[model samples]
Target: MKGVYDIGGIGLTWDLAVQGGRVPPVEFSVDPRVRHSFWALVVGGGSMYMGYVFDQSAIQRICALPTVRQAKLTYALTTVVTSISFVTLSFLGLVAYSYYTVRGCDPFKAGYLKNRNQLVPYFVMEIFHGFPGMSGLFLATIFSAALSSVSSVINGLAANTIEDLLRPAFDRYNTTEKGKIFIAKISVFFFGGLCVSLSFVARTLPGTVVQAAIGFVGACAGPVFGIFLLGASTPWGNIAGAASGLVVSLVLNAWITLGGIMYGRRPVPLPPAPGNFCHVQEVANITGLYLPDPFNNSTGYIDFSTSSPIPVAGIDSGGNPLYNISYMNYALTGWLIAFLVGLAVSLATKHWHEPTRDERLLLPFVRRFWRLNQADELQQAVKLRHSGEHSVEGPQTQKRLISFGNQTSDMI
Candidate 1:
């Protein structure tokens, strides 16, 4: 069992969690100038993108339910489960922190902490070390959960490849059943390999797997969410405006994300070590000592008590605000940028003046806002025919009809 972790004498509390248990309530930040609002934006945006909008699998699963009521019930259940899981994870992290602090074995000092992500797995190993067959079972469970995600990714990629790349490049590839199947297999294999290769790269990332993945997705989430928000909520969301907003948002997000990663980067200052974790040396005891790969940096014990935290970035070469903003804000930045730009573009664009009348294209939840599917004549087209203007298949009825719809537009 992990002992209670404390800095100096105070014990670690769930309220304070892993923030090093400072007396004055230390605020963890990469930069002092970063306000609570900025943190909130990123946290909200990242969470929204990862858990909802960007998670097509989750959306699909919810939609696949037999009834709307059932789907809503499932969503509620999922939310409750997710909240419990988060609490459980937080506890695990605290337990690990306590164990390390009490043992005087700073993970950073013990070696093999390329990124702090390894902490969770390392903690799991220590806790379940002596349990027979339990480790395998736990691993199996983890893999099984991960596999569901993997399947969704592969399916989405394969569909995208066929629709966007393969079918477009070679006509009739998707038209025939045999050709479609072949393309799907090829797409699955290609994307599967790509994802596998990326996993190796993920090992070297500076943050946790979830963080890195979320950051990447967050870069685009803003634009996506912006588009959906506009489409569902606003009558002025034309395709041209939406597309323009997305493009601009993409450029803006890319510039910030890449700049932060490559040039304007600054390592986050870790909290001062608890007790003699840094100054004094300690070793972990286990059947087989946990050894990191040779490429990992060897443990360097730093005297945090004496050394000051690394300074945050001041200004960029272009004299803009330091792009060292946390990746957490990626989605928020993108969404706001896209929404503003899209709104501006929509006001200027011609399409916004005359929006699409196709109610079928609108989301079911938002469909209530759209009064009619088409113009009054087109709207009454179906009703006119149904009242016996002409037979269902007659030339007169077919000629008057521009297209078929349940909502509106029986006439051209």
Candidate 2:
């Protein structure tokens, strides 16, 4: 079960269970048996989220094109490149796991994973395999994954900060282009630096690297995702409904992370050693689905003896349950709550109306395409240029004025 827990990306939870006397001691290593399991979770989850971001961004950009041909080309190129990258990364990760497994080495083993503390030494050993060889390719793949993630976040955040935060402030002050760019660059630098700093802080937490990273991102992004879904899908959703959803999602995520800290639940104790492992037996039985591979067998039964205990409840004053919920389940729950609340409030308020022109412009792709088509239709009805026989503004303008005067005369 310990082996299964690690493979399922729940190594930290299992470790906590062990520390809380919830499970037995077991060897957790990067055995070939488990490497595939661990890497599958990492690559699959990461790529899915990354693909979503790229798709949304690409759609927006494509919509902003002035012509159908431009949109088609842009969409095709963006989709193909992003899809290829995601597929390639998944293949490389699988290959890496297979190679390690065939060699009787476990890259996903507790000690063999390339984390910050061991990354330098790991790379140093790989150098003996030739600087431009398989090792180099492996390192390049890792860098590509990291760069893709960082670039996506930086670009998304920069765009949001500019459009939502900075642009509005500048509109009041009538700031220039250079000033806006300066603010944007500063926003990128600050957000990047803050993330790096927080990552360092995350290292000090008592969880597997994957879990820690997910917890961090999920906690921050859960609310944002809720708001986005609400705003994009619901016409009746007002700012108040969106804000409410955001707050609820954030609070729920925090409650799960801090172990009901807001409700006065005591913190769960950390494991004694860095590589300590655990497993939650109840989780496997809860759904009767065996928690999936490489945690359980084809029959959905896990060997619990090889796993450690995971904490299920925070210590309370009377040893009562502070919150009987799993952190893993919070993501889905938060999303559902936000969506329902936003939808209900929006419909109840009956505030449906046409979106403002500026709001339509915010969807740059749609606005550009629509406006371009409108321009083409108007051009055909009007002369290419003013004729000397007509006013400088052109015959079309004079005709419209004359028509308006005739309408007034008829009204009189």
Candidate 3:
């Protein structure tokens, strides 16, 4: 009776979400801009953080493995785990929506939600509030996860700065190991401080928090993924080609993402309606010109029916249609641009004449191919040298060698 009352009081339909009849079809029309944002999220979310996890930390982790086989195994395991995590989170979102819809507390329609970003937290509270400390525990878990991510970012920044920039200069200065370590420590401190400062600035940055996150990710991800792909896959690629590709990709993607943000399109074609929650009243007794009306700051609901469109960003006053592509597609655009430009530059120039790269530095599958090619070349070289030496050998020695070969052939 207690359990039934609890379930009834909380409006729990725990198993209903899985049934087709109990749930709305999870489908909607998305804006082209939202497509880019979605793609940005997909690519950005693929292996954790694109900047650190893909570029710096993941490589370090891979290299730490005992063998190429182990590295591949690690990647496979990571993929499985991350896929599960993504699916689980997505399902949670669906569960939240379903729960709200069933209870007639659909936040989107009720105009009760102040920010869409708050939906998950609000849902967690609603579901777990009856259970003492569960909500707090859940929040703490989320906070801990965030802290881990920030730590990773700091570590990655330090490692990259040291390896790519600082160490090179320190090497030129004939710095000792201790000096290098000192520099690394300094780099970590500097970057950590910078990150702290930026966190504060990020609070004031214009636009929705989610939009800013995806935009920031889209800005960094495309060019990095492109250049990393080029470097890892192509032997004929040079710094010049990669730099050119990366620059073009970054510039193009940034323009598109920024333009997309400025021209704010709704993801769904049918914007959500605030179902009759608000009623307007005449404010005929307004005193001062500056204080005509007061709006409740806590509300997430806004009526845009009579509001003017946001002022356009970029070259044209109305925003250039050319740059209206979604931010999510930025990664794809940047990657393609970089790869094509990089490949063209590499092919059109002297990169083709460059010496063979270390096969070990590439994927393990390609390593055997390179080794076979090297072995074949070495065998050919040996054959050519033997043929030259054969011409200079005495007739008696040639006869003896022929006799030995005949004997060897007979034994076989």
Candidate 4:
């Protein structure tokens, strides 16, 4: 009842429109220049898609499945479940907005909350205050989520470090099983402590925890995903190309993220806090104690005029075009730059490089094309041999011959 009215009364809204030339951090305006415009959010949603496709942790789990069909099923189910969670969370955002709208107060603009990210907890507390254990349950839920994320990250870091960095040294030294176990434990502690220290450092950074986290992850993910894409899709990508792409893309993403944080302009003030509707006497009747004005004179009109020229939409507050790109585009930008640079480098070094002949390494579509070409070339070679004529040997011919010999040996 009251919940139904709360949702139905307000419905959906983009809040107040930006007046005068000021650009708000979030808006549903038609302008493509706004950082959080509808178009940007639509595109930024791809970041999650990119995460799903390129995330090593998820890939490792999928690979561990007993069969290819099982792996595919697991991937599909995981994506669907994760997407449903995201959609539910998005709906909750609307519910929070509706609750505040009905309450005739905005916690953030009223100075009760410093950041919008705090709104969830505040909303939970406000609604669950009368219920003795509900607020505590919400707190427990938060802790559980935090613990799950932290534990997974720490474990992944520990596993990666041991497998990629320490395994060779252990093998070289013929490390005992107990010694290996002890070192692995030590690595876990070391990584856990390191993650804790980094969290403190993150607190010192600009932007909310959500921004900093996604930016950091997007920057890292972009390059690594690019490398994986290159290796899987392109036969010409050699170690040099992969290395260059990884370094260049990582540096590019880091610069964009850091520059935006350090130099970005702040969003203009939101529309003035909703008019104070709570009366002092009414508060006394409800809680048996008088409460002062909760809004603290927050009704002042926003002034959009400023000395600096109005920034172009989509650009950060600093008016710089490059750094202000939507964070969602970070992974995509890295992917493109990496692919282009890698392709160029691979072509430049083509004389010394041998394209991978393993069909298993190529994408399914690419492998199909490879097989077609292989069959065509094999027919041509046989015809030339029967005619007792020599054809010019090229890199493709060499690769085809090697591939054919391997396949023949396997059949035998």
Candidate 5:
């Protein structure tokens, strides 16, 4: 509720300012008899939130697994199922929207793509009329997803705080489950509250929800993904390589995005209605603007709509088309850059040995093969022991078994 209010306030403020103090009002022009139908559509839209909730639940279930293999399998399967479901639902939503639009309903018709003010109407419409019975179900699913994510975050914080931070300070307190739970809950609550508050600030930022979310994820995850790849794929990948990759990715992304913004190249499009209306003829009529003759210095707003049919190409301040780069490609570029840089550095510092033992232990499927070898060795030792033969190799074999046992225990 607080988040909703904050977002609404911020959006409304921006909308008014952008329109030069004129609040561009959205007036619904529907038959009074179809008011209930409108509400139904709004309610149906609210159900989409359930998909998010289901996704979170699936993630939680996967994370609860003790082994990495199980977790990976669970995650993969769950993701596929959830993704399919989302796609199907989204398709249905598009169909429904098309139906409504054909019938003169435009629930999602908002002025600006970036501003929250435009989003508010759509949200309200969804809540009121989107899905009838499905809205609550979707909302519940969304709540579950939110709670699940919050739980995982709390769990991660608890693990890090206890194992890395608090345990080092108070060894005796580390063993207490209740104490750890309390700390985790407190941390989760505090962080969650902080996040909600910060979201209000984020709402004021000039970008669409999808773009903002994806950009944020890409910015944060790019270096982390690079580091993980380096650690997993190359023994030569050192702290220096990881650090370099992180720094380079961050700097490059920041420069590209911020530079674009500073130069008036907004990543997201502005409002499309009266706000964006411009006279093409007026723009072309300015004599000095793009005149072939330097002597014709008369300056006036050329009404482009009435001028010559030639289109005026308007390039953003960054000297590029606003929609030139697809966001997926942009994010991929960042990841690829990070990966390549990290790999190059790793190749340059080729000194570390492969973590074969750690790999075998960490990978359960590989560990199964390792267990077979151990079993063979154990059988060989047993055969020698039962033969009543005191060969020099028998003691060595027994000693090897003991060593193997220790290694296996340590791995476990």
Candidate 6:
């Protein structure tokens, strides 16, 4: 019973439930600058929204559904579930904070943790110390989850490479089925190694894992999403416009992201847990445990009271404003820049060109209200028949063509 309650508190509420007492209002962000900032949160949300819209896994799953109605329902349900999970995780963070506040101990400040990411693991170990084998089980679970995610990503990349890039070459060379299998096996190993090597590079980057990962994704994925949106929503975009826009956005995002990481102001954390309340000062005095003062120039007795907070270093004081903006803005800015540049370039270069006749390529709203000349419609149908590139295929394509003819006749 004791183990169950302890594990539950640590696992779910993160020590708060075990404490069995009053819980304080959670402080949202340790940094006062970012706390309750509307623009910061909104931009962050925009990044996530665009990410979902353009995510390959999401698109694949949605397309796998048999019906459009089922796809729509799945998307809505996923969003709801995701929102609830996010809220729950957020509350758990609050619980951890409240527990630490009550305990009068800050692990990072106390030198128990070297990195910010270690806090969760440290907390888990602390609570589960009494329960033998449970900690080992928790660790195994974590490793398994991580391996599954990593393997899935690697497999997808390898599969895409073989199917899309190497298939034509293999076909041309008359590569046997077994040879293709061998090549795929080799690709998996190659990509797996490449991924592992990149992880080492990531370890050298500044800031927390969340910031680095999100910033990198924003620099790359944001532009791709922008290009997708441009093609789907607009009629004038061409190859030149998309290429120019993508290149410009990529360069811009990379510059901003790199500059921010290298030269931006570091966020100051909230004040550490009071040493007096934590009895750290008393213990240090009794044990004669003294740490060197980092800031003190004169040789004197070290003041331990204010020694727990991390020293802020490498702050780019009075630097470029663009380089100091929030990381969340990376995606939003990238997307906007790409879309605007693409549209401008497209309009300037191809103003007189005909728009796409394929209604399937456009958004539902755009397709619904679109009207074309009878001649243009007739030309499109003929082109579709020649190209054999109708959105539907086989028998369904013929049915759709007949239905389209009926609709066109009725409109006339």
CA lDDT scores, all candidates in order: 0.62, 0.50, 0.59, 0.66, 0.48, 0.66
- Could you tell me which residue pairs clash in candidate 3? 36-328, 36-329, 37-328, 40-328, 114-300
Candidate 3 residue-wise lDDT, 1-412, digit = tens:
2222323432343443433133333323243333333444565344224443366657877888889899878878877886798777766655664454333234655555765667778778767756899889989999898778677777878888888877678878888889878878998889879978977776665545656776667567767877776766765677778888888888877777766665645343222321232222112213322311222324432233422333322233354654555555555666778888887777777534552446545656665665565555456545644877766557755554555445335435
Q: lDDT per residue, candidate 6, 210-238, as tens digits? A: 67877787777778778887888786687
Question: How many residue pairs of model 3 clash at the backbone?
Answer: 5
Encode model 5's per-residue lDDT on 159-274: one tens digit a residue: 66656677765576445768767776787677778767867976766655545554454545555555655555543466767777878977776565554434434332322222
Candidate 6: where is the Cα deviation over 4 Å? 1-36, 167-180, 276-317, 348-354, 372-407, 410-412
Ranking by lDDT: 6, 4, 1, 3, 2, 5
Clashing pairs in 4: 33-313, 33-314, 265-317
lDDT of 4 by residue, 66-115 (tens): 89999878778877997798776665655665555444555665567776
- What TM-score does each of the candidates earn? 0.70, 0.49, 0.65, 0.78, 0.50, 0.70
lDDT at position 160, candidate 1: 69
Model 5 residue 339 CA deviation (Å) reads 2.8
Per-residue accuracy of model 1 over 23-55 as CA lDDT, tens digit each: 224345545234223454446444454436445
- RMSD values for the candidates in order, in angstroms, are 8.4, 14.9, 10.9, 5.8, 16.5, 9.5
